[model samples]
Target: MTTTSPQIVASADGTPIAYESMGDGPPVILIGGAFNDRTTVAALAATLAPHVTAVVYDRRGRGDSGDNADTFAVEREIEDLAALIAAAGGRASLFGHSSGGILALEATAQGLPVERLAVYETPFVVDGLRPLPAEGTAEQIRAFVAKERRDEAVRLFLTEQVAVPAGMVDGMQASPAWPFLVGLAHTLPYDVAVCGADLALPADRLAKIGVPTLTMAGGASPAWFPAAAQAVAGAIPGASYLTVAGQDHGVLHNPDALREPLLTFLR
Candidate 1:
């Protein structure tokens, strides 16, 4: 197995972002979604390492990254990605999954020097297929996290925000990954902020992303995923859309399913 030492870069706010880089081609950063840290995307990074210099980093307040503030804002997260892009030789491609995809789009809208962008199954509610978060959901999550009710916070996010079935959430809670989910429960608000309260597709904002872009969904994913992906692709001028065969929102777990399309689009 190929291995590399982790590195740290200071964001504009002076928060330290922990990351690892491998391979020797054009730079590509992997941004994982809710409940994920850098480790969750390491396999995908490794799969792309041979063809591109892949950088996987922990988003703020997760894994090895420094958490400098209790308040979560999307701008700060965008600055973190900007700092990583600077570290990746001033400009690089970005690949974000789920809420992280929303963040990437916001970054591009905010004028980050992104060369190419790829996103997988960003959960935007264009057709009202998924329920939008209730007003003040971020504050509610903040209160739960502040009280250290980690399990409750996690449950609220999964069932309410992500719209996972209660029984499925219970099954996940029984799994070994549940504890890790609890550990990162505080960062759920960050994801919520990135996705926004409305959860509607920001067609006007996405249209401003004047870069080569690829939006991907999974054939076996929930009905809303492809719709969201297609909506996003259509919003961004000249952006390409793809559906990974026999995969779902958890396509990151099956790196092989993502590797080819990523290579084809990114190259």
Candidate 2:
């Protein structure tokens, strides 16, 4: 496995974001979804290293990154990506999964200098497939995190925000990954902030992103994912949509499934 020690970059807000780089080609930054840090995509980075300089980083407040602010905003996260791009020589392709996909799209909309962008199953609810969060859902999640009710925060996020079934949540809670989920539960509100309260596709904003873009979903992902991916792709002018066969939302867990398509698109 290719491995490298993490390096730090200061975001515009002065928060330190930790990232590690591997390989020797055009840079590609990997932005992980909720409950994920730099390590979550380390294997994918390693797999892509031979073709591109893959940089995987912890978003602020997770893993080795430092978060000093009392509040979370999507702008800060965007700035974090901006900093990573700067560290990657000022122009790089971005690959974001889930809420990370939302962040990448928002950053591009805000005029970040991205050469190319790829996103996997960003969870937008364009056709009312899932109801938008209640008006105060972000606040409620923040309160739960403030009270240190990590488990409750995790439960609320999985059940309400992500719409995972109750039985599946119960099963997940009993699994070994439950502890990791709880550990990162405080960032649930950040994820909510990235997706926004509306949970609808920001067609106008997404339409403004003027980069080569690829939006993708897993063939076996939940019913809502393909629609969400398609909606996002359709909203963005010139964006292409793809479905990775025999995969689901956890497709990142199997890096090989993503290797060829990403290489082809990114190259």
Candidate 3:
């Protein structure tokens, strides 16, 4: 499972979405969370490629994907996923992480032709384990990006929206990945929209999703993570729920632990 030639498809609004596909058999698209680009899930894509056709792509405002920022809408991103699905042979399974997970759920609810679906820590707030995102949080992120304070935008999203510890955020800034995350700061609002400002589990919308689904979280993550995953699973009838042992929000960087679990559900 190696990197393949990059591909691009025009979304409903004619925004070009760049993606790469590897392996064969049934197709499964991998959608990353906030600040992620296609490269963020490249390793996970590679791990799953041996079992299925794994497609990884840039969301609207990230990586090589073109964004219509003036007309940004969650529907546009759904349309983007629709185009990717069409390219994925009219229908495909989906595996989404964090905000991307929420996006996948929204797409399914909006009537996208997805097969089996899997989401990890969709980041919903349930039972008040974590407070809902404050109103105008997305606007604040947009304002930061507008002022070219990309680092501030990233920090705000991680600390306020994602609830990452300030110390951990500081550690991240010293890491090489911080720059890449900052480079995608403009998309933080898009992720916010994907999760919604309220951050409540969209139970009514999720009820519309009838496909076989899998919801998961890391055992080591904050209590809210599992609660959010469970709430999502409960909303989607018959959805399976599991907590990946010894894992946390950073599971994206450790694809191996997820390989078998995903392949089990995927196959």
List TM-score per model, in order. 0.97, 0.97, 0.96
Best by lDDT: 1
Per-candidate clash tally? 0, 0, 0
RMSD of 2: 1.3
Stretches off by above 4 angstroms in model 1 are 1-5
Error of model 3, residue 243, in angstroms: 1.3
How would the candidate models be sorted by lDDT, starting from the highest?
A: 1, 2, 3
- In candidate 2, residue 108 scores what lDDT? 94
Model 3 per-residue lDDT tens digits across residues 161-250: 988789999999999988888898888888988888888888998999989999999999999999999999998988999999999988
Off by over 4 Å in 2: 1-4
Tens-digit lDDT track of model 2 for 67-103: 8766888989999999999999999999999999999
Candidate 1: C-alpha lDDT: 0.91
By TM-score, how accurate is candidate 3? 0.96
- Runs of candidate 3 with Cα error greater than 4 angstroms are 1-5
Candidate 2 TM-score versus the reference: 0.97
